[model samples]
Target: MKQHTLPALLALSLLVGCSSSEEIVPDVPPSELYSEAQVSLQSGNWLTAIEQLEALDSRYPFGAYSEQVQLDLIYAYYKNDDLALGLATIERFTRLNPTHEKIDWVLYMRGLTHMAQDRNFMHDLLNMDRNDRDPEPVKAAFKDFKRLLERYPNSPYAEDAEMRMFALKNRLAEYDLATADFYLRREAWIAAINRCQELQKTYPDTEAARKSLAIQLEAYQQLGLQEAIERTTELMVLNPI
Candidate 1:
């Protein structure tokens, strides 16, 4: 439960500077403001798009393009790599418009945002493998994708969500494998074998599962358990990965 001092998380701790409630509302008309925002958005000017969109949201809170602006802002934040704001925008949109038609898309984007943040500043700072880092964000991303699939099975994002889930599953498996590898290195034979077995049972179709068999075989060999060694070797032969 160590808290990561990531760049995005640090930003989130500070106040949102451009919030409508705090900043003075611009005097531009809704159409003109929205038009400018659209131009910025179309031109790949994410910062400009955010500025214009924030202004539009502030000045004309109930404008015609309100919902579309919210959606566009989410994409803009994502493209800008502003993950914190993207998450914040998605949260607000879901809370305000829980039944919006694009809720599935929002959930998909939420998963993506979490996915993006999984490799945050800490990873780069320490050159740490993701398996050694905190797994919460990736876990959260997997859950978000799961929610999207379960609630919107017919959604266009369903296929992509499934793919993300598959990747996340392997990532989790790697985490489990890391634990088993640690126990093996420490010569905790029984614990290593138990972890490997649990990993194989949980992620039988994953590459990690196949790799776990090798670890289990090694653990059995280390402990001089001939029967377990033979069974694990057979499993490795059958898996062939």
Candidate 2:
């Protein structure tokens, strides 16, 4: 009998602990939730803003503020460093509202989000070469910026997008140069020359174009291609030093 009583007591203690540990967040009305989310955003409480915005969106999918909520969610997700969520939100918004007047802004934000994700704090702090890292996100941002410019040439965000695109183009060219250098080190002259030629064709005005031309010349010399070397030398001379 004493053993049975001890088991019952232990079960009751466990149940009490579980009940006390449960978190209880009060249910907020959609309007109140949105207001609270706005306050959180203004206060830089990204997590709280995300929570409230998500709740409002879930509760009032087609409410008066639905479109605005979606846009805000994208920005909030970006600020919270949830780049995947931010990009997903942007894609959904653009797909659903293709003709929305503020679509350019969405594209700009998408580009910014991609750029943020691509950023390497360690590389920046250590002055590491960006070309040595992954280029996918940089390429993604470049595409987004380019699309914005093509679709909305007169957009208020056009100038900034263009500037970012220029930088991204150069970065991409530098990546190709880096790869060419790697092939050159491995003595794969043909592969190195291909990469350099591709870089020159794709990013003619990039600073790396000169280096790529030089690499092509070196690869041609390494492979003992006299004709190719002469052609590359002429092209290199035509380009700025």
Tell me, by TM-score, which candidate is best: 2
* Model 2 per-residue lDDT tens digits across residues 1-241: 9989999999999999987654232376777778888999999999888887877777788998888899999999999899999999999999999999889999999999999888888888998876867889999999999999999999999999999998888888889999999999999999998899888889988889888888888989988899999998898888966
Which residue segments of model 2 deviate by more than 4 Å?
1-25
- Each prediction's whole-model lDDT (CA): 0.88, 0.88
Q: Report backbone clashes per prediction.
A: 0, 0
Q: Give the CA lDDT, 0 to 100, for residue 41 in model 2.
A: 94
- Structure candidate 1, residue pairs in collision: none
Q: Positional deviation of 175 in candidate 2, in angstroms?
A: 0.7
In candidate 1, how many Å is residue 47 off? 1.2
Model 2: what TM-score?
A: 0.85
Show where candidate 1 strays beyond 4 Å.
Answer: 1-26, 120-129
Instruction: State each model's C-alpha RMSD to the native.
Output: 10.4, 3.1
